[model samples]
Target chain A: MPDERSADEHLLAERLIQALNLEHLAVGELSPTAALFGHESGGLGLDSIDALEIALMVQKHYGVTLRSEDPDTIAALTSLRSLSAYVLAQRKQ
Target chain B: MPDRAHVINLCAGRLAFMLGFVAAGLRGQTTLLPHSLAARQLEAIRAAYPDCHVLDDSCKSDLQWQDSPRNASLDVDEQATAAILFTSGSTGVPQPHPCTWGSLAALGRLDAQRLTGSRQMNLVVTVPSQHMYGLQTSVLLQLFGDCSVHDGKPFFPADVAAALRAVPAPRALITTPHHLRSCLDAGVALPPLDMVLSATAPLAAELAEKAELLWQTTLLEIYGSTEAGTIGTRRTTSGEPWQLLPGARLDCTADGAVYHASHLPAPLALTDVLDPVSSGSFRLVGRAADQVKIAGKRASLAELNRLLLQVPGVIDGVVFVPENGSRTAALVVAPHLAAAQIVGELAQSMDPAFLPRPVVLLERLPRNELGKLTHTALQEAIR
Candidate 1:
């Protein structure tokens, strides 16, 4: 089951990278487990503004709404894999 | 207000923020509003203002008077220091500017006149209430204007649409050019709006026109900074020349032009070069400082350029703001490094949003006899 979700998360990460206009970052470089928001380095280096941007992108691309005030928002936006899982779950609902 | 209430912290929803603001002021505390909720920034602020207390949605504060222990009256001491908003300092640290309740309330009255002359307005702000612009338009306006503010801070277009829908008519939206662009780009169906207020960055005329057409509402742009509250405004359809708010005068002095508005405590020194028209309108010629704001986060071109030079580069470099844009561009003299390499190195230290895009490698930077790159020289260098 983890293997099946991993492939979809990778594709979702690529799409998000494009949506974010993070051209300086290579798609392969952004790993599934890389920290999204709080980490200073070793990831895509996203900020609060970028979080809104990614949330907007998710809403547009996957029809999944991510609210900043949601208690689970930080966990959902933790990484590419977490965001993908959250989107997948929301879409299923 | 406690004896150590000289410093305070504000981070909450619109209503809570309002209550906290009033409560803190009653106790004679100057609220510290951190633009970024990052732990590091908050920690640094806490260090400076050790007595600071955090306020958020989960705050168990009782808005009702019965449960409240403080007997302080609701009357706002107009002259009391209301808030200290932190801006991205020129030296890469956060700079705090204290704004008085009187100043904010005065600007609110001016904004109410410009936005809704006689009729009341219900505001749904997309920007966080903690921001200076948000604090003024959404929170402070309610102090003087006959306005009811929605409590939610929605960022997404759908959420924004829903927020507007939940609120009453004659509703206005306070948002940034970045959020407005995202809403437009998302193509979400927005509810009918009375008007839209934009600031933080320059709004493109094309996008403004599209938004107005889509919502059939007037779109107004505000030109202001943290130091100075809302000063000037213009409809996007109109070309240039921002009309100074009513009773707000701009006068040229030996030091520079000073801004004296009815709501300000005293005359404020203007840093931007302005050409005042006889009709009380003004055209912005240039800014004295190389400060640029993107997505409401302000950064200095000098600081960014300094960081660019520090990037293990082989040689000289310069960062210049693109014309009529918030994104910055860099011209580096490093021959061995690729654009990606330069950007990657910058990402390590600088914010990804502020990183210079289109990092152009130049043989040399054009400098005059004074070794300062003039505007014409930069234009030629980037070319």
Candidate 2:
């Protein structure tokens, strides 16, 4: 049986990569609960500008406005996995 | 606290509330917020320093605010900025400018008259009153320029329209190049004006030309800094001489960057790169050391780095313009990102001329022991 969660995660990773122009970040490298939101940017080795660009892209693509009001933006943006999940949910709405 | 003096910032409408405390002569931390909320910062003091003798517009009720005289005399001191004025530092660290009573008054009366002829000129500024440019044009210039001012932060095209409606015709719009571009981009119908003043960054002749066609008015570009206040004003498209404001004179250094101030004081060294216009006026080429002229456009390496770091996938980026016939090359560090993807995103907001022509990507950017980029590291990156 196909796992519903895996399908959702793959879809999200693909969407983020395209939207942010991160043509190189393959999907399998990202863990669903990975630390995508906080400051490991220098330590864990991710581009900071890429993160902001992704956030802007998410805001523009999703009808949902990302602002201080939304608590989930920070958590969801922490990693490709989490962002995918949050975006999947936003797509439904 | 004896350490800080209480101030009312009377020009701002919301700031008047603090007047009750400042008028009472209370000495406490008069933390002035950034110019965006100059009025509210003073108003908060009304409640914060009720016991002290304070004064400002916040003290009056809205209905009665009109009747209240805007004038309030302040004792001038060298450390006056420690009490009254505040500004944006751009860098994370923001510092206050020392505005003595004499300096503020000089800025209001003499400075305004010297820059744009006629005392009591109608004033219009989108720059926040908290900023030096905004404060000078809107408030200080009101008292000194002998002019009436229109209050409100005109940010969007709609906001500019509303602000114009509030002020009568024959007004001057004091604004920055950044915001002005956005207004022009919006393609909104604009009011005719006597003049427009551009500051904060160099006003491109192309932008000045666009503004002239749009509004049918002269757009005067100002060249100076927060520390020096506004010293020189020029009409870029008009190719007019940069008229030095009163109490300002120029002294060229070995490098040719102008040093300016009043005759009473020694001329202060300026970072502005200039071409002397007659004896008094000059043209601002760009900041001497921090920028490189690419295709006749001055590009600040610092501002570029700041923008590059903000890109979604860019962990870090550093640019170096080699002196070898102005080779515009930039090196970016993308530990987890691809070089091609990141550079494509950055080129959007940045001017095409300033954008790195041949952007180089690296795994890690080299930095000195002090965490600063050295010339050697820059050369290595370029190679």
Model 2 CAPRI rating: incorrect
Off by over 4 Å in 1: A1-7, A59-74, A88-93, B1-3, B65-73, B253-256, B287-289, B322-326, B331-353, B357-383
True contacts kept of each: 0.21, 0.02
Restricting to chain A, the TM-score for each candidate equals 0.83, 0.59
True contacts kept of 2: 0.02
Give the 10-residue window scoring lowest on summed lDDT in candidate 2 chain B.
B86-95
Off by over 4 Å in 2: A1-93, B1-4, B7-91, B119-121, B255-260, B263-266, B291-330, B334-383
lDDT of 2 by residue, B237-336 (tens): 9777687776466776666665656522345666667777767777666566675544223456787777778888777777667644233566777766
lDDT for model 2: 0.57
User: Which candidate number has the best lDDT?
Assistant: 1
Q: Model 1, B1-383: lDDT tens per residue?
A: 34565544454577777777776777777888886776556777888888767766654365534433223345668888888888765333667888888877778778878767746788999887778788877776777677778988887676787888889898898898878877887777777898899987767899999999998999999888887877788998778689899888889767777888887778889877878875468887777677767667778787888888888854999888766444677778998887778887886667556876556677888889999888888776665
Candidate 1 lDDT, tens digit per residue, A1-93?
322447778788778766665554566667777788655445655765677678777877888877655667768888888888889888899
